[model samples]
Target: MKKHIIGTLLLGGWSLMMLTLLQSCDKQEVFSYESEHALFFERWKQVSLSERYRLDTVNYSFSHYVGVEDIEHQFKINLIGNLLEEDAEYKVIVVDSLTTATEDQYTIKNPVFRKGRSSDSLTVVVHKTPVLKDKSVHLTLRLVENENFGLGYMGYTDVRIRFNDMPTQPTWWTKEVELAFLGPYSYEKLETIVAANEGFTTFEGLSLTEKRKIALNTKEYISEHGITEKNGDPMEIPVY
Candidate 1:
């Protein structure tokens, strides 16, 4: 009887151990393991088209987070379009500059894609730059395609730029200027219009409504002076 009891206890212990091992295996398969340094794609913000022409700038800004200690990030820009023929020519101007108002202070390290590729697509490799922690960098990209594809489709097709992490800053601007040329005529134009006006020197202590009215009147004054022109052209504008 003593031998039978010992044998039964050993069998039950073995059964419990097997069950625990099976549960562990099942949990491992259900969970996905990802590295701490993986990067992701963020949404792109479209800037104003009028600003593009006025400031001669056109681009979009995007950002993603990296959680690794030290790892190289890799990314690519992919363009997709059926309208681009094999012989069509295109240009991509990638300007790497600091986001400041100092005139032409940024450097253009990579001016790529002057001619279209033999295929209907092109890809540009983006490597990591030296950047500080918790701060974001900006990359200005201009896609100029020389072809006639109607009003809306004149430029590059299916445009998207990708970014990867680097240890250093690529290039950026310290300060930027906002030009509100149409502030006086628009309903939402604010007090800043007075500052932007060429004829005004000081609007020290004006109310919000007073400032808006002044801006509207300034718009009329400029129109009477023939300082503005209107065209139905549609273009891409850059917004900060």
Candidate 2:
């Protein structure tokens, strides 16, 4: 009886080990890309990653371009397989149902993976119009299989761009900026600050002294002009 029990335990251990080995082999085969070339949209580094990587959704605005006529919005596309000696052409198509911009509002440029490069830029020419000021528009792009490349990583195959010319708060207006220099933010206060300091777009890259100086100047300007928010609240800057 003792010998039979030991034999049974040994056989079960062998079977479990074999099952694990087979599953490991299957996973390796799934992840292996021996000779296939694939393409995926690269995530922007400035944003935090959601799960394993950041989603390829980009938000753009023309409000930053005070005098520019048009903006060439660009996104990075990455290659998965080995680099080629010659340039490889890739194709991108717009999901019409998901896109809200008309043909005249934006133009998509041809995408190419340059020779010896692992990545390339996909550019879209976004035209600024009066309509964009009041409402936003969206353009969704997807990578399709072409002669030179295959769609890679289902999650990264698509990219969505939301663009507008509306006066929205800049991403640089973080809690740190408010606690350190700027106080509670409002569109009116932002406009007042920009008016006081020519081309003041961001609180970044400015020294503490410089930011304080500009804030003081803006405060004086607000007091002199009696500028108030759209809600009729007093416009104040806390630099002290």
Candidate 3:
């Protein structure tokens, strides 16, 4: 009777093992030759499989980089299907209707997936034109189907990049900066302060006394010369 029970247990275990193997085989992916030649854009830093991993648009502000003529901005293009042993050139073109930047304002590098690699960097050279100081421009890049590659994910086939040199209010302009130092924030005021104060970019790590002195000097300067904001409002600084 014991031998009979042992035999039955062994038979059941063997059957379960075979079922698990079959299930794994079913779940395995089978890629056709045509399906292995697709590409898409995704953020290289994201490790998640969620939809957020797909990259659609990116924004850059040349305001952060003062005196920089141009910069090379790069984003990742990933392979959806298979890695190749030989280099594969991909086609990307700017959508003229969606692009506001002039031809000389930017340059797109030739996109190519290097040999034995599944991804490559698509670089664009963005120039800091005078127009960007007051306004922003968009550069939209779309992937075109070529002999070597096809578009991968539907929504991630293209990316829009908007760049500007316009300076916005810094985060360090807290309530303290408003009530105790500068009364109100203005782009013109900030520009004036940055111009007058050498090597002063942000108010992030200044002492209270130093801030008070700078505020007093700026207030005097504005009062003496009558510097107004772009909206014609009087630039005022609180005195305490």
- Single out the weakest 10-residue window by summed lDDT for candidate 2: 26-35
State the number of backbone clashes in model 3.
0
In order of appearance, the predictions have TM-scores of: 0.22, 0.68, 0.56
lDDT of each residue in 1-240, candidate 1, tens digit only: 999999999999999999998976753322221321111111223367543221222222222212222222212222333323333334444443533211221233342322343122233333334442334344444444334211121222123333333223112211221132222122112222333454442234545464455546655654454443244222111221
How do these models rank on lDDT, best leading?
Answer: 2, 3, 1
Ranking by TM-score: 2, 3, 1
- The TM-score, computed over Cα atoms with residue i paired to residue i, of candidate 2 is 0.68
In terms of lDDT, the poorest run of 10 residues in model 1 is 33-42
**Cα misplacement distance, residue 173 of candidate 1 (Å):** 33
Residue pairs with backbone atoms closer than 3 Å in model 3 (clashes)? none
Alpha-carbon lDDT, every model? 0.34, 0.78, 0.77
Model 1 segments beyond 4 Å from truth? 1-85, 95-122, 132-134, 145-151, 154-240
- State the lDDT at 55 in candidate 3: 53
Q: Which scores greater on lDDT, model 1 or model 2?
A: 2
Q: TM-score of the candidate numbered 1? A: 0.22
User: Candidate 1: global Cα-lDDT?
Assistant: 0.34
